[model samples]
Target: MAAGEVTLDPEIALFLREMRAEWAQHPPLESLGFPEQRAVCEAVRARWAEGGPRMARTIERVFDPGAGKLHVRVYLPDGAGDPAPALVYLHGGGFTLFSIDTHDRLMREYAAAGGFAVIGVDYPLSPEHKYPVALNRIEALMLWLRTHAAELGVDPARLAIGGDSAGANLSFATALRLRDRGEEGLVSAILSNYGYFSTTVSDEAEARFGGPGSIMDRAEAVSYYANYLTDIERERSDPLACPLLADLAALPPVLLVIPECDLLTEQSLVMDARLRAAGVAAEAIVYPGTTHSFLEAMSLAAVARQGIADGARFVAGCLSR
Candidate 1:
């Protein structure tokens, strides 16, 4: 398939093929004004407000220790054992949108497929609390998980972390922090999907891969990066601010998923290179014919749904060891 032409996934191939012509009739994001973009995002999320596969056991309103009053949702596989392997998820919305309710389905599916526990943290967004605040919330969640491993029935020792888009960025930064603090065995693997990193976009990447794919636009990346940084100097070196800039050695094995149609594919690929070069065990898979945030459209997009399966497979392999 060509760069923009994606083959549909077997599960939703027919749907995508049929909807292609209809979706082409109108651009999804163009209708939104600056104010409406937030509303549009919320409206779309409300439509899928109840996220995840229907079969998993989900528990909501859990609190984080470090960030008092912070909330998280947990997904436990049906009949999963005590102290099961766990995967903590952070939702991606360019650090602006998406709540636990928005991504419940995807988290549940991951828990069910991997037969592990899934924790979804609803961290604070940027330009309000800004970069480090969100990262701090994530790190606190990790530390809290480690502290309450017994109560939560989580094997923090066999844990994995991951997220989509902005969430994936948090996971990457958290992994780096864990490595820096000599905290190994806290996470066995990480599943990163179209994770955001780097403010330095080449004119070439911007020119070629700039368009709509699934939920977000390729052009929005520049804006997201700008908002993420409160200070330009700090942005370059804040290991917590930009994970791709941090040292990758001593981190747990990672599974990086890069979708061909997303603008962040190049950024993710660059992280993959860094992880490998630093001797971290990492496997990055690029899903052809798909765009970013594919997992959110399990009901609508075929290849997007397949990416979830791919993620589950990666998690299973990472946990097997």
Candidate 2:
């Protein structure tokens, strides 16, 4: 199918329409500074984060994991047992925007749907934190979790790491880091939800999905990469910064939740092929008529719910094995 030709799912389209309307009320993000831009983003996303699956137990903590002080939230669903399999989730904002609070309900939904625990990390954002700052903290957290899983009632052996967009990039990069350290088994699975795996965006993707009124455009994406990296030309090809360039062999199973209309869709598609070629078990489910960040519309979109459920099932299955 031609890019931009496929229609957006009705419910998802409605969600986008409402989001655009909400955003229209705010000043242009570029006109504001980073702090103001984040504030505006939070205000806009606050409504979508409300009223989702409630957890049986939720705990919040702040701790130094050798890199810096980090905040994490743990959600335990009803019926989850001690030493529960946990998915350490990272929120996506191109490494600059969004937070655990903004993605709270999405984390809760995963915990509830999977019947397991979900750990949401409040990793530091970019332009202030830059590359490897958040990655260092997150990797330290995972290593810390390996020894402290019992304290959090999580099974250290069954832990998985996953995220959307930049989060997905971090998750995969963390796995690669662990693999290099010979601790690859620490992550049993990876849930990549419309992951932003590289800095490159094709002309076709730009033409179809990077135009006016799109959820994300080329310039905005470029700005995000610029925010996250100190040197784009040098870091753009770094396997850690762009996991699509990494060796994929011997990694844990990966489930890629791809939205058909997203600019980054091609990255996920290419990664899927590369993973399989490297003998890693990888599954990519392309959601038709969907766009980037569509999973956040779970409150109103069935496709989002299905994507979450599919991810939950994949994680649960991987951990069980």
lDDT tens digits, residue span 1-321, model 1: 233444444444444344454445444544644345555555555544464556445666656578655787777787556777888889987887667767877887788777888888888766566778888877877887787865766777778899988888889888887777777677888899889876665655555455533333445776776667788666767766778888788888788888776667788889999989999888888876666666666767666667778888888777768
Give the root-mean-square deviation of each candidate in angstroms: 3.6, 1.4
Instruction: Evaluate all candidate structures by whole-model CA lDDT and list the values in order.
Output: 0.73, 0.93
What shift in Å separates residue 53 of candidate 1 from its native position after superposition?
A: 2.6
> Ten consecutive residues with minimal summed lDDT in candidate 1?
1-10
Clashing pairs in 1: 6-289, 51-104, 51-105, 52-105, 52-106
In angstroms, give how far residue 127 of model 2 lies from its true place.
0.6
Query: What does the lDDT come to for candidate 1?
Result: 0.73
Error of 2 at 177 (Å): 0.3
